[model samples]
Target: MKQDIPAVKQPVRSKILVVDDEPRIRDACRMVLSEQGFEVALAADGNEGVQMIQQEHFDVILVDLMMPVLSGFEVLSHVREAHPDTVVIVITGYATLEHSINAMKRGAFDFIPKPFTPDQLRAVVAKAIKYNRALQDIADTNSRLRTMVNRLTDGVMATDRDRRIVLANPAFLHLIGYHGESVLGRLIDEIHVSDQVREMIGQTLTMPSDEFTEPTEEIACSDDSGERIVRAKCAPFRGRDGSTIGTITVLNDITALKEFDRIRSDFVSMVCHEVRSPMNSMMMQIKVLLDGLAGELTDKQREILGRVSEKMSGLTTMVSELLDLSRLESGLIANEKSAVKMNEILREQVSFHAENGRRKNITIELRQPESLPPVLANQRNMEEVITNLVTNAIKYSPENTTVTVTATVENEYVRLSVQDQGYGIGADDLKRIFDRFYRVNDQNTRTIVGTGLGLAIVKSIVEAHHGSIKVSSTPGSGSTFTVLLPLVSI
Candidate 1:
């Protein structure tokens, strides 16, 4: 039985055509070309050669100048007009300087003397094959790149150092409201870009180098394409010499994303308002009943009603938080900032949560040096952030565990960290702990009641003040929440 084996890969062969009236010359040329790993074809004369050229594609062609029926010059002329990419070499037994000059003038790649050695022929063919392969590769690469650029959905453009448009892909033409004409040699400012995009482009071009600015991602506006949100980025297009050649800008349309956000924001505002009305009514009724305005109740009845009031209060707090978050997102919240002593704020929050902590048998401890640096932040926002952090620490900690609030000065910022000894958060849950409505769904903390918006609110408030917040935690050990705010320079 024949053994089952993979076939050896064959190398790509360059095709060569030999056109000579003499059979001896044709056979000799074919043998020399084939030995050099080329696929060889032959013709008895110039007429036959022209016919073969019309029928097939060859990388290199060897033609004899003098032939029957048709002269070598005619065949060369026809091939040059029809298949200019093919490498053509002329060979003849009757050699002359005029013959070589005339052959080269007719677009012959090389002129071989009569009675040429096989070595000489092989050397010429080898050089032609290398040159042909390089040209073909470059053509293939350019074709592929052009296809890729045309198919892109994101707009891409390149401009010269003087800001003249050098290249614009199809998507870019659609974005700037132009087509058909090659915009390569046109000035970019003359293009029909919408006013908003033009202003952004102007900023990038003319902004002072001393005044550095962050690259903006999205801009919303009306254009010929209707409303759109174009997210663009620009970079210095560089040359091989490591110098700035121009700028390349890429743009992506995010209109759908902006629309979705608008709808979601409106929906949240509507739902929160609807729920608050009924909740406020229930709270008032609960207060009336707790005050004995309804009827005298037994000890158990009062206890149950009291717990009902507490639960109602928690729901009310959550609703208020939702309203606050919605207002913050909508930019409806007034940024009334002032000099805020963080130490005083921390004391106030701890005192307020003392009663709630007592219910859980948890204690709040404050740890900081005297005369802490004041932070430039909204007083109300700071209160909310501190309260949320302390409340969460107490809520998650087991009975008798103490929650500590620490303040310190670091560089130009005030760093406040809240540490708690609770059923610690897992590594995975810790990552998304501050996400709105994100909770650690672990067996250990499943019984813990939370609205899941507390930490998210804290983070939003901290960032709104141009500060930052972060959490550090370990399973079965504990977690620490830290907030950093820029300290008001004296």
Candidate 2:
């Protein structure tokens, strides 16, 4: 079969304008540029050149310095003011150093002496043509980028090192509730926005150039409609030399997602509450039968009932954890807080888990300075955090291994870390360990009893207290969970 070949498109010819008082010079330049595949136009004087420029766009303009009606300097000024992208070249009979410098200072791309050869004209025009094309390309790219950003729904903004707004799309202005036409060059602090957003941007602006961490936060914004949740992410913007120049922030509306999450958490809470009551009653009745309060039973009957009780207990524990998590998600937990001595909390958790560790033949160690700064935290919530971490450490570690709990002061925060010599998590599993009901599915973990809501609850509590939690692990070595809480201000 004969396939049809696609036609190749020819490159567009560059347009050139020659403006001179001399008729012969105009004709000769036009003929030369036309022969070089440029669309050429002829103008008699500087006034004629300006008229032609107004009529149409030209890639390059060759104007004579000494002309009637208007000087080349005037035409250069017009081109620079009106069509800054158009390349201007000067032609002069008086080709002195001063003339060339003045022409250049007036924005001329290059100048050629009047008594010149065809090759010299071609060389200078060729250079101007190349420069003009590059400028056009850059302008086109910038236009396209602006169009794309303007049409986006997500808000995008950029700031300079001085925290002045350098670029912003219409969406950004709308998101920030700004009614002005432009905010360029205005200080970011002048804009009305949530302090959380401003603080995030400030952090990115002050971050080390070598660090490319992007900080993200979900903040609530109120308007006529209602309260809207916006997720703002900020990162350091670097220059060509890899130095931090400013910051870029992107805002996305996530109000619907947050509402959906609230609905889901409420539903889970209801379900857990209803299930827990009946489960507890059934467990109580089962215990009665197993204790021979109702009647004596055979060995097999007792064994079956025991197994059922065990399964029921597991289910009950899962329900309780789910309810706790739901409450955390609904912002009903951790409401009451005060200055808490973290060292005391650490000591209490270690002592509480010491018996369990000894039953498994594992050692529990506590390491801390005599005195430590207190953290602003809920006493019950902090106790839960320490209990969950220590219990997990002891549960995961093998016999004869040691679990270490440490507390230290880090800047304005208190650092609590629990290290365990256990079957560590894989990289893929580590990312989602804090997600609700997410459990590692390895063989070693299959034997471990967990509702998988412990870490999720820990994370929620930490964040509610304006703190952070981090985990690091190796495959066979162990895992370490670290929490940082702001210290109680004096």
Candidate 3:
């Protein structure tokens, strides 16, 4: 049996209508446009072309001037009124200055002479289509951008290199305490907070071409109430000839975040003081009982008491650390600067840690140069700095492993280092090791124990002494903690 098959029709192409009195010109134009994938229709006169345009949709129309019945001007006007988007190109055999001008005035896209080549017609037609398409694309993109800019909550402002505001979002207007009408075309310094910002703007603008290419850093500006921090990014804008004509800047406000941090720090200090008062009294009572000032007890009872005392001691230390950290962050812990011997301080700290080191079977080595500079620091703060680092070294290190405590003068500063051969800090914890209540290791369970304030207190004390502390470690190779103290008042 034979099977029946159906033929499929190709999709219709874009339509083009040709209106000319000359039969040869119309035929030639139709043949060229038809070969170039346009569905072509021919009209003998201007009236016929207008009738065709009114009846059907055409993407482009080629009309001839000086027609027999109704002139090309009549057809052009009628098509433009009825089908506004249909491109109208006038074709004239006897080209005249007045005729070409009239066609353009009547909204004709282009006027082609009779002697024009097929390639010329094709190029002009393609260019006109591309131009219209590009214009439509730009309109659509602009509509979307305007909608987005209006909807955004953050302030956004774009300025030319001349520092004049070009475009600004509603958020930007609100942030700078202004409205659109007040800000446009105004220099940045006009709305800028103070003399400092005005100077910064001037400096940045006057910067050599090389430096201005990079983004501006985070800047702080003082407003009516307080300071506001904002991150600013800048990029050079170039013109059609690719020369840097201006710059664009984006500002993001971070004032609320900074204020929140300050409030949190104050609350922590209040809580730490409350907790420290009670813990200090409790530890004092425990110390009295352990010293036998309360009464006598058996060896086993004393041993049990000793363990309890040790744990209480840990709690007391934690409370002290909390107080120290709170004081440091709140800026309440100012250094009581004094010119004191760094070596004498180190020897005393090492001697104190040596007692604890002996129980762990760890060797404590003190390396200090005899002629050491007197560091400008509070004695108590520097002592705590030494004690915390040395105590940490003892805790993490194994039996008989060496803990080296060294103090030496370098570059008008006293450098104290505690080097330990122990389980070193993990890579992830290195950056935040000094943050309060942050600890490294599975040994950080409340049972395995720490108030997690050791490094934090150490950091606070070092800073209070007008010093900086740094720690470097490897997973197995062990760690080195260094404190740098200025030799003179700073």
**Cα-lDDT of candidate 3:** 0.74
Clashing pairs in 2: none
Candidate 2 lDDT, 272-389, residue by residue in tens:
7788889989999999999999999999999999988988988888888887877776653315355578888888888888999999998989999999877767788999999999
Q: By lDDT, who's the top model here? A: 2
Off by over 4 Å in 1: 1-13, 18-28, 41-56, 61-124, 127-131, 159-167, 182-190, 194-225, 267-436, 441-490
lDDT of 3 by residue, 1-490 (tens): 9987777888657778889888888888888887988788999998888888889978778898888879989998998899877788888886799888989999998878988899988887776666556755777898898779867876666666687877777876665656445677888767743343344444445545432232345566665667777655455555565445555555567677656656876776677677767767877876787788999877887788778877877776776666566666644332434557777888888887888999988889999888786775667877777777888888777677889988887897888899999778888989888887887764522344577787888887777556799999987667999988887421
Off by over 4 Å in 3: 1-111, 117-119, 180-206, 212-234, 238-243, 267-490
Residue 458 in candidate 1, Cα distance off native in Å: 15
Which regions in candidate 2 have their CA more than 4 angstroms from the true location? 1-10, 94-97, 272-490
Each model's lDDT: 0.79, 0.87, 0.74
Q: State the weakest 10-residue window (summed lDDT) of model 3.
A: 209-218
- Write one digit per residue (lDDT tens) for candidate 1, span 267-320: 877877787788789889978887889988788988998888777777777877
lDDT of 1 at 468: 93
Q: Report the Cα lDDT for residue 464, model 1.
A: 74
